[model samples]
Target: MNQTVRPERRVLAQRVTLAHGGGGKAMRDLIEDVFTSVFAPPGMEDQARLMDASLLEPGAELAFTTDSFVVSPMEFPGGDIGTISVCGTVNDLAVGGARPLWLSAAFIIEEGVEITTLRQIAASMQKSALEAGVRIVTGDTKVVGKGSGDGVFVTTAGIGVIPPGRRMLAESVRPGDIALVSGVLGDHGAAILAARGDMDLTSDIRSDCQPLNHLIEAVLTAVPDIRAARDATRGGLASALNEVAYAAGVGIEITEADLPLRQEVRGICEILGLDPLYLANEGTLVLFVPPDQAVSALAAMKSVPAGRGARVIGKAVTAHPGTVIMKTVLGGARIVDMLVGEQLPRIC
Candidate 1:
């Protein structure tokens, strides 16, 4: 009889160095000790071998997406780089009506970053992956000079399966469709800004960081014919709505009075002269459903933990095609155009 021998785990240095990226024993130890040990990816192969019964179903389609996280202050009030890296990729798949299954994370580490930091990130990634019902199947790591990069930059790629007969397209949005948001907007952006502390600002707001796949599932279960969906991330809700309006060749009108916002976020924006509508959010998403089923969809979203604050913010219109209009609480209208330049830099 033959048996396989497992190698004992090796201790790694307290801080990363160039030796860890040299593809030698030091590299092996670093990978095994910090990342692989936490992720527990199947096999020690260079690539993942994936198989699923869902993939075998007729008409099931594959969905793939990749994103990079370079948020300043790798660790924040509600989450860190690892948490966002996984959530960002997973949300991308979820909003597109995909069931995320696998992820590959690649890290560009700067020399001297603490080993404990990497471990924290890996653990966060594992926790998030579990919550999203996905796996960290494979990954790579590269170390650069301390000043050459941030403490660490994470790039993640995700794969999912879209069930047959389910199709979501922005162009499918019609004038009668209603627009809804999962929850409060601008929490993540406000939280990240306060966390930086460069502006002598202080706030108790935490990043709205969490996996949205479950919420997406709930909404879809209630309204399978959701016309379009998009996670409000980098450019925030305003930019996302603009994209959809242009794609569908329809006009979008949102009521400021109905927008869900936290007091802390509003105060921060007011003091900084920033627009909350253009602020980023990690766990928030906007979707369009037929007017008749909009209430059902809102109820479904409210049933999900991540979407308890969901609200019906606006609706699509045919009056001004390819435009986004906002009806302010003061009975005035304004164009919520795309962000011209970076409002906050290095905000993942």
Candidate 2:
């Protein structure tokens, strides 16, 4: 038995069992697995062969990316696969210091997928891509026989342009640099947990999923000398910070109390035995600045819409090379280790 689940809460309770991936009625049911029933833009119905690849943009550099959607519960409190596919690509380019220009989406649809559901998802992708000031230039579609693929996995490739003199690279970070985050953390992972019906507490800690190119633009325009910027996504802040530390060969010391985690998000972490410091944030950013330029950079970031909550979370210290230390809320300190194992697997 496929154990029927509510159309709106499809992905939860109904785990992607072996049969769901099997070609046949079971596979179709999974593809049409309606979670929150996303409503996208107009006329964005169905992926069809309008086709042949003569598509080429006139001018601009490209930053390509591709990711698989295996997020346990696709329809979380704030976002879904359709939007994540777009926003995720947008942030990758944004944090890389590029102005997102366009996107190419590829879909791997399993047998038995519903036309209506696919249309809804397409609308979502179209809406997000448009809002981020990027166009969906081209893409591909493929069907997998029963049991050969998951319901519907999407891969998005993007292209963007980086203006001259606005260079950003991890190697640019040096001694006496400061670290800043755009906003609160842990919202995304917590929201996914809640949406999965994890009855730890009564709450709706929606995912903080937002494209950050505009925010990045505001900062770079004001302070083009930025060392590096990164969006703390999948592996969470811990993973992102660690990568920066190793790449820059510098130590990052952050204050635990300085972290901007929503109270409800903090509460959920407690109930679920999770740590906000290592959790994921979709809309946030990690920026490195020369010590003398921290104040002005903070001001530039705070002036932006997505960066209203921006603050100086910490600074690079010469003592702890290649490591991140977070002062404990209890007035003590502990090393924020890189994720050795999946903290909240499938939460992405």
Q: Alpha-carbon error at 269 in model 1, in Å?
A: 0.8
The list of candidate 1 runs beyond 4 A from truth reads none
| Candidate 1 residue lDDT tens string, 227-293 | 9999999989999999999999999999999999999999999999999999999999899999999
lDDT of 2 by residue, 214-282 (tens): 898888877878999988987788888888889888898999888888999888878778888778778
In order of appearance, the predictions have TM-scores of 0.99, 0.81
Supply the TM-score for candidate 1.
Answer: 0.99
Clashes of each: 0, 5
Worst 10 residues of 1 by lDDT: 5-14
Q: What Cα-based lDDT does every candidate model obtain?
A: 0.94, 0.75
Instruction: Find the candidate with the highest TM-score and give its number.
Output: 1
lDDT of 2 at 180: 93
In terms of lDDT, the best-performing candidate is: 1
